[model samples]
Target: MKLTVRSSTISEGEWDQFILAESPWAFFQSFAWGETQLLEKVAVARWEFLLDDRKIAQAQTILVKAKRGTFLHVRHGPVVNRELVNDNLLWRQILEFLAAEAKKENAWFCRIGPLLANTQETQRLFANLGVRPAPIHAMDAEYTWVLRLNEAEETILANMRKTTRYLIRQAEKQGVVVKASHQIEDFLRLYNQTAKRQRFVPHRGIEAEFAVFSKRGQAELLVASHSGQQLAAAVILYFGKQAIYHHGASIVSKISASYLLQWHAIKEAKKRGLEWYNFWGIAPEDKLEHPWQGITLFKKGFGGELRSFVHAHDLPVSPLYPVSATIEAVRKRLKHY
Candidate 1:
């Protein structure tokens, strides 16, 4: 069968329908995400691959124009309908299409972080295509902890580590309150404090993120407080059947308010009839000294399956690609990611 690729200017509903129907769905590939990028002054393009007039694969590519250079990024996607025709030809055609799109967009390179499992076969496939591992991850995490949310609340609590359960109860007993709101100022205040304490740069576009997602009714800001003082805050995104713990921040306090905060988020996910609660990212087990080790331990205590996705792959489209690569390589090392 001859495969053809074309750009899409489809409605958000149409795009979402295709994305939700595929396995391993991710909000990063959703049309709303594209809109978020647009709000950040980034350009986004959606492409679809058709086999005999039937859509078989789709990707929402974002054009990230930095001071260094411009690069195309596809996060957790190029969702392909494997039941239709799962073969190398489909992927090769998709790559060729992306390369063409990159050239047209004047992008220096293209980075893809597909939702494929991190396995020898997946690595080999990208390697064979002459794609190199991205110096820095396009998404901060290539591995995540995910919990199935179909079970009853008691059963879910019973499955958690004893320590995690205890912490949640302790926070509750201490009068920790978790509240959901659409307000961004309070979350931003706490988030900035977290960035300062952690010695990391906070995402500057967070307000835009909250504004866009909340307007669409697909996001929420959950705040944890004790004695009327905020202790932690999180931004959660709901898409398809999953509720993602997209971003979080906390003050350096002795209180275990964050535990109950997370528990409340899980309950909210269940309340929304979501089938999965995704604890966005975690460090690999072997990387005991990794920067994410502390949070990884905390996430694991809640009990969930670990999912590893294929590492980000870069396909150079311009001669200037090496310069960006070199800069990112140093940045990656400095960030300890």
Candidate 2:
């Protein structure tokens, strides 16, 4: 009946094992996400709770500081043991502890958008904790386009958009070869090239993935070659039940290789027994004329279900808070930062 809190001194490997084996919402709770956040110098706090019997009940809440106020979030979790997420007493204890931690940090709010799975009791628990469905606080929606990996390559191919299947075969006929690499340098080269070509800024936190790949087995670089020359590359991350396409690059002269590389990555994910191949994200709904149009069409060609999750939500806890949260939203729109 007692509750104990401890800092997350557990090694990355240990944390990963607990996530994969014990938590359904493993992707967000992963050490990979934590490592990424850490490399950005975002303040992170992890607390694990145990029952009187010493059984682990749950672990969660990471704080990322911002110019306005700190953001307290749960990546994919607050993984309470399945048994305890349903128990009223235990769930109450867990929420009280989390609230206290959030207040202590002077955070504006704590936000969590778990992978789309929960029981009725879990919903009730969130409601009881004053967790309302505030779409504004989510960083990324759990709803995503997913390709099932349990089927044969042929079956999977058959399910793809007609254009996607044609492009894959066309790339093969044009002598494109896709290969996997664990080298961080190779991924960086291609990623930077594409970032410049596409007129978007390159992400600053990429080195974190290199650090992770050196220590863990969650990331790989998939490259496509034409006549032995590298033409395209993608950085992919694998965790829990899903394989995610994180970043990509391609030569202007050999764009077909990009198609080949993605196809190869999906095949590899299937071989590794992953349940889903996630095409990370697309614009809110599909608009052919949007700036992200080209990429959106490419992802849709893979023929996965179109889904959308609730938007991010936040709860303010600091004394410097404004009367309305709308000011931040307006600023983002004005400056487009």
Candidate 3:
């Protein structure tokens, strides 16, 4: 089986459809995501791997300009077709091409976050490619939570934690309401409030993300309200077979509007006939004190299986990469990530 990689010039619909039809679950690798990156001042590109001219895999990469080191970042990507997931040679070839491209662009390294299982064979594959675990904790959602949507609504609610179900019901009885929104500002207002309260920097270009994906009918913003007061909001990315709760925010309130908001999103996903509702990232079960622990408990209460991926790996191109890695390790420790 001959394999070759080339720059992708496919139309946006075709690009997204290929991802939905052929690859693992990763909306970050979707075509609309690249456009969002571009709007955020991150240059992006897409590549397609072909098996004798038949497209088999695709990767969306961004050139991250950082003072520490400018590297090519593959955030949860190089999504391979399920059939070729076990083909080590193809994965190696893909990385070889990406690493070469990074060097040509003067990048210090090529950092990839593949959606492969955290297993022994996966370890061996990256090891053979000379990749080391990245110094930063995660490039994206390396350990995510997902709830399958094929079950009956009663069953789904029954499976959730008792407290979660109670909270959701309480919100409903208290007259909390969730509605679909086209306005990004509605979500952004709450999102910004959350970032400040949590002492974390909110990501730039969420508006751009909403615009790009919403234009394609691949996104929705859900807002939870009571007495016309916006209590909580969330942005759900509908990609592949999942409706992912990718971003969220809420004001401090005694009411359990956030819980109701999540339930609303799940029902929306089920209404849309999605296969899963992805809760995005959670702290590793082993790291009880990680930054995401609180929210992790919140997400876990909704009832879902944990999906752990091999950590992001760095394929070094320049000797400066080692220095950059050292600095990153220090920063990660300081952040407790």
Candidate 4:
């Protein structure tokens, strides 16, 4: 088969068309993601793999500079054609190109969080590629909660947990309103407070995420309010065939505003003709006490099946990679996530 890898100049329409056509979709590999990364002043490289004149895959890579070491990060990629899932030669070729790019950038390693199932078969594939599991827990979601929107609205509501349904009703009775807005301030005000209150490092891309995606009408701030008082808010992104609850925050309240907020978001996603409502990352089932447990439970109440992507793998490019790995290993132990 003929193959070619095109860099950075692919048109946005061609890029998004390929991404949206993929099964399950990968927002991390979307054009908006690259734009968001650029907004943070991060270096990004976009690549498309074509075979026989047909686009077969794409990888949107980011250069992550850290005191520990700079590295190449490919989150939830390379979004590939299903037929190429086990094409070892193709994968090796892709990595070779990535490694070359990393070397040029003076990166220590290339990190790939493949968009594949987390299974023994998948593990063996990466193992054969001479890549090791990344020292850091995950660069993206390993386990996500996704609600399929193919069902009728009534059926979808009926599938929700009893308490979830009750909470939604309570929120509506309390006159809570959930509005989809482009106002970043509506999300950041609560989001910043949430970071300090929860004591977790927040991704610094909220402004960038909203600004970049909103430009394409692909993102919104879904805020929940009761009598003009903000109770909960989220920055949701519409990419591929899903609406992803990418970032969220809320204040302590008895109004169940968050519940109503998600309810409407799901409906809005369906209205947009999207096929899925992705609650993004969630704690693994076995890790009941994981830091994400509270939010995981909330996501589960809305009813969805689990989608676990394979753990990230690192392909070393420099001898100093082990030093960076050691630093990250120590960090992992201290982090509950």
TM-score of each: 0.95, 0.81, 0.95, 0.95
TM-score of 3: 0.95
Model 3: residues >4 Å from true position, as ranges? none
Write model 2 residue lDDT over 1-337, tens digit each, in one string. Answer: 8788888787877777767666643566777677777777777777778777464644556786657557578766666665555566775676667667788887766665654343565566566665555433223535456777888888888988888898889999998888777677877887788888887778777778656754677788787888877888888888878888877777787447777788989988988898988886665463434445577778878767755543444555665545335566665444332
1-337 in candidate 4: lDDT tens per residue?
5569888586898787877666355778888789899989999989988888777888999999999999999988887788887788888888898899999999999998867988888888998999899997654767789999999889989999999999999999999999877778878889888989988887788898888888899887889999999999988888878899989999988789999999999999999999999998888777655688898889999998998878989999999999999999998767765
* Candidate 2 segments whose C-alpha is farther than 4 A from its true place: 11-14, 54-57, 84-92, 118-128, 132-138, 196-201, 227-230, 251-254, 286-294, 306-311, 321-324, 331-337
**lDDT (C-alpha) at residue 175 in model 2:** 88
C-alpha lDDT (0 to 100) for residue 291 of candidate 1: 77
What local lDDT does model 2 show for residue 271?
A: 82
Ranking by lDDT: 3, 4, 1, 2
- Candidate 4's C-alpha runs over 4 A off are 1-3, 51-54
Which one wins by TM-score: 1 or 2?
A: 1
Candidate 1 TM-score versus the reference: 0.95
| Candidate 3 residue lDDT tens string, 217-318 | 889999999999999999998887899888999999999999999998999899998999999988877776678889999999999898888999999999
Report the lDDT tens digits of candidate 1 across residue range 1-337.
6788888878999998988887445678988888888888888889988988999889999988887789888887788885742366677878888988899999999988878778888777787777899888435457889999999999999999999999999999999999987778989888888888878788867888778889888999999999999999999988899998988989888899889999999999999999999998888777666678888889988888988888888899999999999999888777776
Instruction: Give the higher-TM-score candidate: 2 or 3.
Output: 3
Return the lDDT, model 4, position 168: 96
Give RMSD (Å) of candidate 3 vs. truth.
1.6
